[model samples]
Target: MNQFNKTINRLGTYCTQWDFVKDRFGKDDVLPFTISDMDISTSPEILLALQKRVDHGIFGYTRWNHPDFKNAIISWYQKRFDCPIQDSWIAYTPSVIYGIVKVLSVYNPQKKPICFITPCYDGFMKILSSNDYPTKTVHQSLDNGVYNLDWNELETALSQSKVFLLCNPNNPNGYVWSVEDLTKIIELCKKHKVIIVSDDIHMDFVYKPALFTPIIKVAQKMDYLDNVVIITSSAKTFNLSSLGGAYIICPNITKLAEYVYLLGNKDSLSSAPALFITSLITGYTQSEAWTDELIEYCHQNLIFVKEYLEKHLPTLSVTIPEGTYFAWVDCSKLGIPMSEIQDKLLNIGKVAIMDGDRYEESAPFLRMIIACPRSKVEDGLKRLVKSLL
Candidate 1:
């Protein structure tokens, strides 16, 4: 068995994924597959690094300007994606969402509308809504189980919008954007003079043959890097979301400085914890093998899900994800209401999965997190079969 197959007990760690399911759904026996975080243990190198930090016992204010941290990020990008990132272009933020919020605030001085592909990360819509920023959601059309960008719609939306928030290797559906598609997007954004903020936290989760083209790479290739900013972290790749450290990579030095200036003025912005920075460095530098194994394991889980659904639940269809551990299962064929599906899964099936409508309202889908032990995934599938079949 792979190390990722070992089920670490996360019940009492205040882990919202497992521990809070009972309170949230009023059920003690529910097996939660919601939330993007993994149930697997973190990389051993990360654990050792944290151990060393704890042994020191001095949790003082740490600077984000550490050469080790920046160098690790720089090396990881260059090695993994063949993308070049500079130290000066990087700026730290507490999380990807926080970085995005700062970008919106800094760029949209007139508060012009923001646009993004729909069935996206729900947080993007929520954050924009909370800030009273109007948004144009360009829903991706599904063709033969793969989602593609509607170029005409996107161009139109970009023409009217001030900012375009992109989710490369998009959340929920897990479609890794191709370089060609990304190039077209960059060209369109350039034509419309729209600023691009790409949330690429899922870049590393892509499956084989489906490359994750970072926006910066595409922009650099086109020599139009001035308008793009990338928000990413070790959080998703290493399951370190709780540790709280994400960074923004802005190619334009002047715009990067503006973001730094605005973020500096915010009294509420807190620096990442020492442990988080240590984990980032360890993950970027020494966790490549562990990550590769984890992705392979997840690919097997993806295959298992595709096969199981085809055999046991022939009426339903699943979008075979090119990236990420999520299986976005389409239940529209059943003609059941989304709420009823959620109710049955939570109460009858005793399995916790995210309602698909949360990503796009009225979409007959359920997002299942498959980054757990195979036994656990089998259990969830069995429960799903019992509830819906």
Candidate 2:
């Protein structure tokens, strides 16, 4: 086990995933695989940077003109994904969800619709719902063990909508869209005049043999640069999500600048720790060997979970994930209603997996976060198997 592998009993130390769930499930103890955050601690380099910022003791307002911050990001993209990104296109925001809301509010469709893929992050639906904006979905196609996009359905939906939201390496299914596939999506969107907001938050966690192809890269090559908007964060990769730093990389310089001037609120200035975390993007570039090791560990953890379920709980099945540490388990075999399954999992199994109802099209599949210590994953699955048995 790597150093980050250990039981998280100190979870009561302000961990919302652990503490907040007690009241929700009416149990003092519940294994929380529900929330998207990992139980694994942040990288030690990230912790040291955060602690340094704390040690400074000022906590003053911060800005993002730092060359190192920008360079780190640039280097990360260039070195890791081989996607060269210009420093000028980066737009700052506290969170991608909030950024999406802001973009929707500004783009403010009157008759045109704002669309989200079904069984998405759920938070995306909530954001649009709270604003009472009409939306549409492109249901995913499940063939045997893999999930894929329904191009005809997607084309149809885009033909009717103005703004389309895309989750690269999708949430529940972990389906990483290929460049060719993303090209099709962009072609459809362009035909319909749909502006694409691509959330690549999970871009950094892609497992090999399933490389992540950013929509920006595809759009640039297709010269549809004006049609795409990329939203990404170090939060997901670095586990500094709570530190609140998100960015939008757009090539429509004139429009993006206009946006900056119009809505350049205090939120645009990323926090010190957030900037620091961005600085640590260099670590990934510099520590490819280390990242390779982590990726190997994650791959092993995924294999362990799949094999355990297949061997011990043959009835339960998980779609072997292509990206992200989340395992989308089809609980339909349990013969339980989606909500009822969630309740039993949390209250009886004492294991908290994300509910399927959130992803409307993929209802009855629990989203299990496997980005934790191997032991925790094993124990959680053991509890899961026992409860189901």
Candidate 3:
């Protein structure tokens, strides 16, 4: 049997996806396809590693600067994305967003605003709003279903921005950025002298034939290495999010030291996670096959969603994402307002999925997390169809 075929229940586990569905959708009974985390179990090899750490039973204050763990990340990037980095470029943060926030702490947003292509991750919006940071929202041109960068607009935004916060394999839509796009973006940022802070947490989920061009590679190629900061986590790929580990890859030696000193001394969040480090060691060394199998499973899952939606609810379109195990579903063909659609999905269908509005999209779409067992995918699709019909 396929490993993905195995089922597990997360209810009563206090999982935000299951136990606290009401906190998001305001309905306790709805089946949630909302959170980005997978409902399926993670790699067995990773589980074993965590179990071994648990058996050791000495969970004291830990450090993250060992070469073994750093080399694990380096090797994975080299093998997976053909991206190379050294131990000096790595720094530890508890989460990707935390690393971004730390980077932001060093720059003044008032002089030049942060710029990013929208419909972007809502977390980006929240961070800007909370901090009162100036920002420029570059709108990507949506053609048929895919989103393409508007170079002229992007250039304009970059001119006035200090930083470009990039979401590779952009959330809510899973558009794996092409090499050309990465090159052009690096060129623009270089031209404007703007720093790029790339959050590539979804790099592993990129589908085949559509490559995930790590921005760091482009930066290195363009000799713009010092201006780029690569922030990513193993949490998403290994389902080790609850383990709380993330790292930053800053090639600028001076800035890398600054991040370590500040995030460690000032922020007090630079300590390593014992289990998270162990999982990375074992998962990276042992779970290559498991991850490959997962990618194939998720690729097929994305296909199944598109096919099922087409067959049952023709008007509801699912944009076949080039990466990530998410379905960017469009219900605009129904001509129903987004609010009404959201209401029906919650109140009537009892299917809780995230609305695109969360990602600041103008379209009435739902970003469904399809990285679960096939049964849940079908169940959510049926419920969604029931809502509209």
Who wins the TM-score comparison? 3
Candidate 3 or 2, higher TM-score: 3
Q: How would you encode candidate 3's per-residue C-alpha lDDT over 270-330 as one tens digit per residue? A: 7788888898878777888999999999999999999998898999887788988789888
Task: Count the clashes in each prediction.
Answer: 0, 1, 0
Report the error of model 2 at residue 76, Å.
Answer: 1.0
- Once fitted onto the true fold, the runs of candidate 2 whose alpha carbons sit more than 4 angstroms away are 109-111, 266-288
Worst 10 residues of 2 by lDDT: 266-275
**Model 3 CA deviation exceeding 4 Å by range:** 109-111
For candidate 1, the C-alpha RMSD (Å) to the true structure equals 1.4
Q: Is candidate 2 or candidate 3 better by lDDT?
A: 3
Question: Which candidate model has the greater TM-score, 1 or 3?
Answer: 3
lDDT of each: 0.87, 0.74, 0.86
Give the root-mean-square deviation of each candidate in angstroms: 1.4, 2.2, 1.2
For candidate 2, give the lDDT of residue 107. 59
TM-score of 3: 0.98
lDDT of 1 at 149: 67
